[model samples]
Target chain A: MKELKILAVIAALVGITYYGIEPYAHSVMHPEVSAADFTFKDAKNVDTSLAGNVENGKVLVEANCIACHAIEKAGHPALMPNADAAASYGVVPPDLSHAGRIYDKNYLANFIFDPVSAMHLSHKYPVGGTKAFPMPSYNWMTPQEIMDVVSYLQSVAPKVTEDKEGHKATFEAACGRCHSMAYAKFDATTPKDSIKAYMGATPPDLSQYIKSRGEHYLHSFINDPQVLLKNTSMPRVGLNEKAQEEVIAYMEEIGDSKKAERESLGLWVMLYTFVFAILAYLWKRKIWSEVH
Target chain B: MAEFKQADSMYEWFDQRLGIDKFVKVMMTEYWIPKNINFLWAMGVLLTVMFTLLVVSGIFLLMYYKPDINMAFDSVNYTIMQEVAYGWLFRHIHAVGASVVFLIIYIHMFTGIYYGSYKRGREMIWISGMLLFMLFSAEGFSGYMLPWGQMSYWAAYVITEIFGGIPLIGGDLVVWIRGNFYVADATLTRFFMLHVLLIPLAILGAIVFHFYALRFPHVNNEAGEFFDFDEEAEKYLAGDKKNSKVVPFWPVFLSKDFFVLGFFLLFFFYLVFFHYGFAMDPINFDKADGLKTPSHIYPEWYFLWSYEVLRGWFFEIAGISGKSLGLMAFGFANIIFLLLPWLDRSPMVKPANQRPYFKYWFWLMIADLMVLTEFGKLPPTGPNAWVGFGASLVFLILFIALPFITKAEAKKVGGK
Candidate 1:
């Protein structure tokens, strides 16, 4: 009986050891990396065709930008194209394809050299007008590289357009389920207190008010609402500044567009519940095994 | 007639109730314990009891202990201060108990070597005992780090990095075990799991098998005599003539054991209560931060010999990169101990029976160990390192040359 007891104890120990150490062994043998391959050359490679002069702007990007940003044609796998514009690495990669049509060489040059002073938004690149991602400063970049990159960008980028119809449809598809039109009338019986209580803040009527706010302010406010208001309750709309401005313009043209307001909220609720259910199931299984 | 019948009935009833006769029969006939066992024989039982104490106290502590780096030190303090009832007593007993265990085991091995217990028919037992000693050391050192104290942190960092001395893949191997460039949360967590679970379980199993093998031939005494059955008396006796005193183990040997146990308890209580055992260092109360190197780093006293040897060897070879040679010498020193049972082979088992040459070398080894330990404790200054290095080289020479001298002495005696 004593021998049997010893054997049983040894068996249990061996079982536990195998279970505990095997996972660590597996982890050590194989390390995990993300699918996005961000190489150094892509961010720093200078486009000679964009700039009339042969400049070393690519070297500046390599030293300062490649740590976080990837500027290659492949950008990042998760980013998708919308309305012929492509978002890169979940951020709007300002398209140099149309730079020549918009800002002049000098405006672009000033913006690149000291972006904080030129943009007046407390950040260099205010994508979707939100501070979700901030561009790192390249103070070490020489004045010539800055001029060359800006000149290169100005030569290649296309003219900026104010298209409303395409943006309105996409906005409705993505966000209409969650929000109501800013000007949707409140019922007399529906207490004003309900709006403050339900929305958790004063919901603004954007139908007429949005026109007064320029495309830049509307774009900045939606992309990163906190950048404009320190305590804004509005969730970041997750759009790039250019996309945000287009959406705001689209909303103003349609005056009280109801499609986006109705659908976005329900989709968000369903998506959250689905994720919660899967997590709950896994947790329950883990607890059950421990108890047994 | 009636009185005689009543007495007979009483005898039968007593036999049925107590089974005293059967117990006596088993005690007299079935028990085969050796009669020639000595003080060194008690070490096995003492070690067993110490291991039991450690495991029981460890489990109790583990109940309240949290192994995470952020929580480990606080949890130990909590165990002592708030959570478990009388937890501090158990924690201190276990902590001090570890040192005491090693102390006893070292004496046991020294006794074994002095009496030549690792001779023919007992070499396997000695080897197994040596393996157990190594395992125990590993178990204790690994467990020390689980508390994530300042000493535990520094001790682990210095010790584990010793493996980095292995030429080509050394640095990578150390980093792999550490899970980062420096000892961090991953290293703490890994050490904790190994300490609490893996190594202890291995040591426990090995100890059981070790004793099982030990029981077969029984213990060799200071007189180096085995047991011989006296056919005329129907009992076992020592092989040696002068030492052949036969006594039942229960009454005679039990008395001596009780006397030893009493002294042991007195000393233990005095250390635990009156003398105030190992002081809990305030530095150990702090968490391990690898970026912050401690002013002085030293291992526990038991490891001082090897530590000293490495330090001394490095110092002597000052021109030849002390760090590399010091690490190599320390490792080589440990491997030498592992080779002892095979290295020292003589027909004689007892110290008195052995040649004078072997005796001198044995004492010299002990003295070298003490000097090395002292040298290990000193900082590796240029002069100290050189002195230590010279001392380490002398010790190594004595250690290797002793066996050859013993062999030569044995050959001379055989010729005579």
Candidate 2:
């Protein structure tokens, strides 16, 4: 009986010690986000809030999209497919902040309402762009949700004048052959001529340019033009400082504004630390115990 | 024949009243089992109970476990989280039990060494134990991959590929085992079968033989003094002999064993309940994508010393390629234990009676193993590789030099 009691006491002590250290071991080994600080406002505009939701949209943006898009104030795109690469294959998510000013509200509405039409040049928007990316269309979204996203974009979109000069230069250099450049207006009368008239070579029609290039290709071209059309006569025009601003402004005439991506470093660190701690504790308790 | 029947009846009568008091008195008065059996002697009993737990829990898990890569992880999760009542508890206990078994076995082996349990008539036991260690390692490696998690997939890949270092047939051997260039569903299935059935069966057989051989010579008690009992004392020890305190096995050793087992089981349960399960990740929960390597890849902790040895070889010979040296060093480290029975030639097995030279070597070997295990856990970084390599060399020197040094000391002492 005495022996049994001693045994029970030892067992109890071990059990208590294990229980005490368990959370710490788990914390160090498998850190996960416990706070409601990060969430995705899905296509339905449902506010999926994380614990602490302290930074509002900031943390969510980082966790979900920052890997591909620049979100944090200091974060840069680590794997942004360049314009040439994007245009060649046509799979890319464009910068959203300045998109509201580029495309007409109606065009933006149609594209967001159905990304497939944006993805493929359908008969309705027939221009048949070469680039192809299976950009998942969010058909599940409500019109109200889409409008909320547009509103978010409109609030943060860069000022219109910041990119006017580059648009004018591009219009003069490429679109000047067939259209008038007054108030950034085009003639819309020139025939689809041979490949030798616009900028020393006749290019594809501008009316179907968005449909042909697609959102991804267009974004990449605006970001870095040389990447898309190699030795082609599409002179790398809007890529320069003044031209880039203006061209982006011109493009916004055709694109919808969207929220910038966010990057959450705190969550990643927490997770890494948790996993490390658990492994260390287990290893120490089991294998390393043999040593001491 | 009548006397035998009377003795059998007497044993049956004694069994009915089994308890600690009667058992202890009998052992003291009859069995002649050295009263000096210490903490070290308790390990054998501990190991036996631990093995029983391992086998029982393992069998329960095996009944529901699917070894195929596709179902392995899911089956484990289902068994623990949903299927059998308290299934999760059982699985975690078994998983953690493996670690505990290894822990106790290591202790058992070390204790054997400290008491010269490997010397003379004990060579067979020592050799069998070493084989058991090898089987345990194989069991661990095979079971580790069953979960098909990130660490499991990668560790299995890296460790199995060590065979590729062989001159001619290495690649083929690896491929045959894997059934593909990489470890996948087939490999998991095969390993699962081996882990759940074949290796375990072999381990059980080996353990029986180990004990059978052990009983032939009886156990080496703490005093390290070999004794020959007279017929009267032997009979008393066996409960038929007079002037011996022969305790019934039941409620005597049985009760003590249960107490120890209870303590261990409590520790095991505490880890399982509070920690949310053993540390191994459910590898199959995440889909295996070859392109994305897990951030950190390491074998389970038990294999860390050999891992460290392999890594240490990289920096040992500066001009030589790190790959070859690393392989050789790891191979050498693993096989070193196998050579132990032949290495030391001390006439005395007890630590207290062993020559100082032999003691120095024994302690150094222990230190070397500890260092290797430590080095294994660390990431291959800046000066760690060099440190591991340098330490390994020192250990190797100590290991080889110890025998010769002991022999020289013995010659000097004899001359004096």
Candidate 3:
């Protein structure tokens, strides 16, 4: 009875600390927030009746986008080199080769229409802010023109197969310009200093983010950085849901690839240990039988 | 000693030269252990088993583990976990073993205190065990740095900074210990050596001392009864096994030990396989960035209570700063258990249940430690700070009051 009482005390103390207090503390420290909505509701809508013309879109991209941006898959390189572009724009602009596959359509349209407001970056570039936003908004383009540009980009974009290569390609296109995957031996394409100046801080290496921030948090944070962290330098990446899933999958593959192996092996280890425990208990009982 | 003439077999040849049979008799078969002791006494054996697991797993980890700051994080996370075969299993076992070994150590310690095993002749055993505890704590702290992650970097940074609280040479002491102004490459390499080599060897030596100390007083029983080992072991070896309170260590005592070990392994491996998240902090997954510190940082669970004791002294008393006072209190809290043999002056040999005040004291100590550990993890702000401060003060007051309370209890026991 006394031993049982002592056990109860220990169990109670351990339980209250681990289960009760720890969770309570964690809840306070990391208060849960709803995932960011990726509806892109407020963006100016493209008229669905007018079908996009890829040829017109190509003409438009050459006229408007080529001076500053690149569509390497479409054989139009940026007029300015990466070093000059980084110096000028504060970061090397991403190549538009996989933009259509990676970004949500509505989000991309909105981003082009109003680069400042679309990325939830109004706080960074205020009406009377000292520095101008790097990318100029193409507000004059009609809805049909915008749709055509989107279509052209999509047509030239390499098809992203649902596999490790696809995920890696998507991640590199979307995030690798700014964030490095150090574990995968992938470095950010843009110079670190330029990125620091552009984003107000260099983006963290994404190697172990899956383990640290976890899947749900990553989803919310990537969908809209400002929602979780007020005025975070990180812009909304505007990855489509599928693209987002792929990015997260790639992160997990890099960071926690052994998770499946660990889980599968756990069951076998548990079974073996359980059988051993049962046998040991029986043997203990048998040995004690002689003494008793 | 002079009777052996020729080798009967390979084993006998070795035995003739090595006294293997005599060694087994002294250590196991003829060695006596109390039969009346319960499963709580099994904690010592469980601790040994866990130590062996840690060492075996640690050896595997050491094969691929890099000490350099540039490669350490990748060596652990990428090379070990992803590249090497079954490396994750070994890492999980080592990580979880390091954490769970403390749990068994705490249980063993509390069991000793509850039964007053440290009260009289068992002082050396208790002291040697405390020495091992200190070594294990050092081992855990140093080993944590091998991952080169956010928590590891900051924990080493924060703990090493604690030395700056010392007077006169304090500032230099910190830099000296780190071998630099900060916990950088030099610090990491030295801690790597300590974790992998120095502290482990010290711990092995201390374990030998602890077991050697145990051999003298033998093991105390559940009822805190003292019996002559030779007398009871004779009864046990004769036909009066049922009447004897002692049994031989090898077959009879080891059967129970192995049984308890089975259940312990079940719980331990369950942690190593499934519930290992608690042992490995998520923040630690992030590679260490000296430029960017995490928003919140705390030590591992085992050190939380003492850590809280340091943090709890939140305000300056007189001219002495809270940091200095905290550092002293933290040091005191860590080593206070070593003084337990002399602190409780009560002559009573029975368990805490037989002593009125000591029972409440023991339970209260357990509860206070839990509170300290819990609050230690939370941000030291507002109510958390006050609660921790109160608990820490209570912790000190309890130890301070021990001699007086036990002295009065001793008088009463003597009167009875």
Candidate 4:
């Protein structure tokens, strides 16, 4: 009875602390937020009626975008190199090679119309403000012209296959502008100092982000940066659901490549230990039978 | 001697030269243990198994582990966990072993205290065990620095900075320990040396001393019954085993021990396989960046109680700053475990259950420490700070009032 009492006391103390209080404390400290809406509902709707002329769209992109953004797959080299552009604009503009494949169509069209307003970064780069945005608004152009540019980007973009290498390509195009993948030997296109000035903190390398932020967090955070952390400098990359998963997959490929192997081997290791434990129990019982 | 008479077989030849039979007789077969002990007594064997597991797993980790700050995180997280076959298994085993070893150590330590195992001639057993505990803590802390993750870097930064709270030589002491003003490459390399080498060697030596210390007083029983082991061994050997109060260490005592070890392994591997996230913190997955600090920083679960004591003092007392007082309290909390033998002042030899006041004191101590541990991981604000302060005060009062209570009990029993 005394032993039972001691055991009861221990159980109560440990149980209350871990199961009862610890979880309560954690819940209080880190209250749950609603999951991020993957649908870009707030983004401007695309008007499907506006038919884009591919030939005309290519001419417009060459005239307007090629000066800043490179469309290398379309055979148009960037007019200014990254070093010069970063020096002037305080951020290197991303290459438009995979923009149409990775980005949401509506978001891409809206972003082309007004960069600051589309990203809700008007607070940082208000109109006529000293700290104006690097990307000039193309709001003066008609909606048809903006859709044509988006259509041109889609025409030039390569189809990303749905595998590790394909995911790597998507990840590189989507996040590699600012984030480096050290494991993959992929350096960020933007210079460190330029990005640091652009985004307050130096963007963390994404090599181990899969393990760090985890899948669900990365999903919500990537879907909408402001949802998880308010006032975060990260602009929502506006990747569609499929492209986001691909990026996360590529992260898992590099960061936790052995997850499958580790999981399978865990079963076997547990089984072996279980068998050994039973055998040990039997051996112990057999030896003790001669004692009394 | 009869077993060593003839060299007819290889075993006999070895026995003749090395006295293996005699050694086994002295260490195992002829050694007696009380039969009244519970499964908690099995914790000693469980701790030994944990230590052995940790050492074996640590060796495997050391093979591919890089001590350099730049490469250390990748070497462990990427190279070993991803590229090397079965490296993740070894890493998981090592990480889980380092954590579970402390669980077993606490159970073992508490079992000693509950049964008054440190009393009479058993001081060295408790003393040596305490030494092993401290050594294992240092080993854990040093090993925690090797991964060079965000938590690893920050934890090292916070812990090493504690030494700077000392009086005059505090500033130099922190630098001397870190080998730099900050937790840099030098600190990681030196900690790697200590974790993988120095502290483990100390623990091994301490284990030998602990086991040897047990030879003088023998293992304490659950009911704290004193036994004449030599006579008991004779009784069992002379075919009156059922009447013997003691059992041989080899088969009888170890049989029960093995049974407990079986259950422990089931639980241990269950954690390693299915629930290893508790052992490996998610925040530690990010590489170390000294410029940015994590929003919340806390030590591992095992050190939470003492850490809470360190953070418990929120106000200045007289001339000393709260930080200095907190540091002193933290040191006191850790060092007080070593003085358990002298502080109890009890003439009683039985377990806490048999002593009225001592039993409540033991339970209160357990509850208070648990409170401290729970409050430790929380942010020091408002209610958490107050609760932590109350627990810390209880902890101090419990220790300070121990001698008085135990001595009063001794007087009630008409003993010294």
Give the best candidate by lDDT: 3
Ranking according to lDDT, highest score first: 3, 4, 1, 2
Q: Quantify all predictions' global Cα lDDT against the true fold.
A: 0.57, 0.55, 0.88, 0.85
B1-416 in candidate 3: lDDT tens per residue? Answer: 58878897999999999989999999998898888877888898899889998999999999999999999998999889889999999999999999999988998998899999996699999999889889999999999999999999999999999989888999999999899999999999999999989999999999989999988888999888877888888898887878888888888888898888888798788889888878898899988988888989999989999999999999999998888889989989988999999998888878887896788888889889988998999999998899989999999999999989888887877833
Residue B317, candidate 4: C-alpha displacement in angstroms? 2.3
Per-residue error for B94 in candidate 1, Å, reads: 0.9
Residue A162 of model 1 has an lDDT of 46
Question: Model 2: per-residue lDDT, tens digit, B145-228?
Answer: 876666678888999898888768988999998888888887888888889789989998998888777755656766576765
In candidate 2, which residue ranges exceed 4 Å CA deviation? Answer: A1-292, B1-33, B229-232, B235-255, B276-278, B281-287, B315-320, B352-355, B412-416
lDDT by residue for model 4 over A1-292, one digit each (tens)?
7656766765675577665234665566566777765556676644535877778889899899887888889997877877788888787888899998888887888888777766767667778889878888888878888888888888989987789989999998899878888888888888888889888888889888888887978988888777777877888778888899999999999988878876787788778878877887898778766665
Q: What DockQ does candidate 1 have relative to the true complex?
A: 0.01
> How much is A275 displaced in model 1, in angstroms?
68
Query: Where is model 1 chain B poorest over a 10-residue stretch in terms of lDDT?
Result: B232-241
Superior candidate under lDDT, 2 versus 4: 4
lDDT of 2 by residue, A108-206 (tens): 444456653432234222346653223444446555455555444444545533444646544433334333322234542233332233234444333
TM-score of each: 0.52, 0.57, 0.94, 0.92
Q: Write the per-residue lDDT of candidate 3 for residues A98-123, one digit (tens) a residue.
A: 99888888888778878888788888
- TM-score (0 to 1) of chain B for each candidate: 0.84, 0.84, 0.98, 0.98
Each candidate's DockQ score against the native complex? 0.01, 0.02, 0.61, 0.50
| The candidate that achieves the highest DockQ relative to the unseen native structure | 3
Backbone clashes counted, model 4: 0
TM-score of 1: 0.52
